[model samples]
Target: MTQATPQAPAFQLHDEPGHLIRRAQQIAVSKFHEVHGRHVTPIQYAILRTLYESPGVDQVTLAQLIALDTSSTADIATRLEAKGWILREVLPRRQRRLSLTPAGEAILQGMRSGIEQMYLGMMDSLDGTEQREFMRLLRKFVHLNDQQNKPVDTPTKG
Candidate 1:
């Protein structure tokens, strides 16, 4: 019989990307539910808030703004439209744009306080300096990671 190969040891705490991401998502989801109740998800609220801030934004732009794939954005938009939370309108010679309906606005208004509280709670453990540094590092990491996906020869100037 052949000898068996040795198995590799598992990664340490800092090296576990999947575990870290999952744990972070779990904590964030629980905190979000605590703030917004069980009805709304963080993603749904995020899309709604984006629409609220920039009314009539195009779906393509929205997808880019939220860092989601085109298909995922389309799915979310379709669901929100069905729920009467948003209106998707197509203008002549232009792309489809998204706008918040009155009901959507009303729901968002009700969620504003809780959302703010959720933000506060998420960072409750961090002092001002730590919060700022954490935000800075997270942004830097996302920016660099996104850069890796950029197409070569894309114009630098608008």
Candidate 2:
């Protein structure tokens, strides 16, 4: 007689950390769009905000600061330039330095209130202490995992 096939362990999708994180991101994006409209995306806002704060940061460095890949950052820069919200200046060696334009600053200022509302709406369900604790834990989790996902300048042969 043939032996019975072994059963595989069950997996719970809803209980997975990645699933929860993705769901949270979806909610955050939805809230952002609701508050800010679809004119600017979350990534675009991040890039705009970073450029506003840093001013004249190179493309690669901007990518690193925003935790985005260079290709995507370049694409976003092109889009922002097209929108007249930012300037991408070419430096020596083909590096592009990004700076937010006056229009970008104006848009950011316009969205300031909505941004605060979006954040408040997202965390409204949590109490003050819980919100702080949640933020702390989230930062801790990202910090612990950051090294593993950081882009390597040179590829390894392994």
Candidate 3:
């Protein structure tokens, strides 16, 4: 005889968002690991993509764009530099910039197709319009979250 499945609690957005986010993150990370055949963190992918898209972006800009602290970005950059995937050049006259070596470029290009395919396959349920709407709402959510994390200064009445 088959065992009965347990029932879940009623749907509640506040109660479910965190669980949903964690599950999605786990699934995405698993899929990425399967595709890459190694343990590549999500931040590394972000750094690689950012460098690939905008060559010669300085570490400061990279940190800001990626929403990482300076020290963490520095550590990541150092590791990537050591791996020979990236190079950091010091410019005495100008801001030091980071650029991906040919190896980095090739790796990113190689992974680009797979990444695109992964996203397309995952979002296959959503049509073009739905996908666009989803992206829009996601961006809105991110912006709101950023705002929420900012310090709020209350007005003082004299």
Candidate 4:
């Protein structure tokens, strides 16, 4: 009788969905910086756009909306305020209401063309149909995992 040898499992880091998603994010950020320059980061752009649409939202709400932790959101808000791009108002309960300033609006307006170009560039390899399908699937995947990714709400100290 001949002895049988066991084969190694077929596992590849590049083939992992999580790894691919992270790489895609890196490419997106790189493309964003290429178009928008270093003046603002992708996260900051998100915060600015969110505030533009829903102005005067409290810090906690902003954090939830942007899928960020409160501490990070507060830090970003402070940076935006220092840059004169956003205004932060401290509420009675120590919560801060955030809103964009004229400078922030101007920044968004200037980046509009670049934003479109960057998105197009990112998806240039795919056809229109493929792009749409990719986006649809991406949205579905994110939505399905939304609950799992949400930040835990910490109890407030009175």
Candidate 5:
């Protein structure tokens, strides 16, 4: 005789917004990897994309721009540097600035189509209106919860 599956808790994971958001993130990451992992990780792509628009930004600024912690940002930068996609230099006041090398720009150019497809695929489940509304609501959610959702840049001085 086949055994029946055990019942889950009344509060199912699928009904949770946080769980759903995380699942959505996983899906996006999978698509991102499928299209671009051979060339660069998602965070690296964010860094490159930001640098393309705002070159010569400092590490701290770049970290905030991508909503990543400074340490993780630095680590990713190290890997990107090794890949010859970025250059980091220390300036006065111990600030480190990041710039995209020509290689970085070219690689980003190559990945543009894949990136577009990844975005499209991720939102393909929604109709055009739903997609726009979904994005708007997500942005609003972030704005409303930014203080809690966003990582603190630095400790407040006493």
Candidate 6:
């Protein structure tokens, strides 16, 4: 009789950090949908929120600030423009800058309450101390790995 080959250990998907993070993102997004509906998408909200905070920024800079690819930023901007929520103006050098329309401002203002509740809902599983620690650790995790989102060409020498 031929000897059977040994099998490798089983992989654990549920205990993985990437899987957990992805699931967390899904939960947050689902909550966002439940609260905000089809009025805006998560990326659209990111674009809108960034525009609200930093008005009159060019597309490339906006993309960098939001950690999105340039094309995605442009596409989101177009979608927002289509919805009449944002206005695009060409400056002296023909550079397009984005600004939220009054309608956009109003919409963003309306979203704030739901957004707050969404945050609370997502964090409900954690106690106050755990919530604070989670926020701290999450921020640290982002801060530590933010370079992963940056251009490969931007990596500095060791």
- Candidate 2, overall lDDT? 0.93
lDDT, residue 120, candidate 4: 94
Residue clash pairs of candidate 3: none
**TM-scores across all candidates?**
0.82, 0.89, 0.77, 0.87, 0.85, 0.86
Candidate 3 local Cα displacement, residue 106, angstroms: 0.9
- Per-residue accuracy of model 4 over 1-158 as CA lDDT, tens digit each: 99889875587889889999999999999999999899999999999999999999999999989888889999999999999999999999898899999999999889889999999999999999999999999999998798747778999999
lDDT of 6: 0.90
Model 6 worst lDDT run, 10 consecutive residues:
147-156
Cα lDDT of model 2 by residue, 101-156, tens digit: 99999998899999999999999999999999999999999987996467679977
Write the residue-wise lDDT of candidate 6 on 1-158 in tens digits.
99999985476888778999999898889999999997799888888899999999888899988888888898889989999999998877767899999999989999999999999998999999999999999999997889746557676789
lDDT (tens digit, per residue) of candidate 1 on 14-101: 5786677688779989999988897777888888999999999999889888888878988998988999999999867757899999
The list of candidate 1 runs beyond 4 A from truth reads 1-15, 92-94, 147-149, 152-158
In lDDT terms, how accurate is model 5? 0.91
lDDT against the true structure, per candidate, is 0.87, 0.93, 0.84, 0.93, 0.91, 0.90
Q: List the lowest-lDDT window of 10 residues for candidate 3.
A: 33-42
Residue 120 in candidate 3, Cα distance off native in Å: 0.9
Report the candidate with higher TM-score, 3 versus 5: 5
What is the alpha-carbon lDDT for the whole of candidate 3? 0.84
Which residues of candidate 6, in runs, are more than 4 Å off? 1-11, 92-94, 148-158
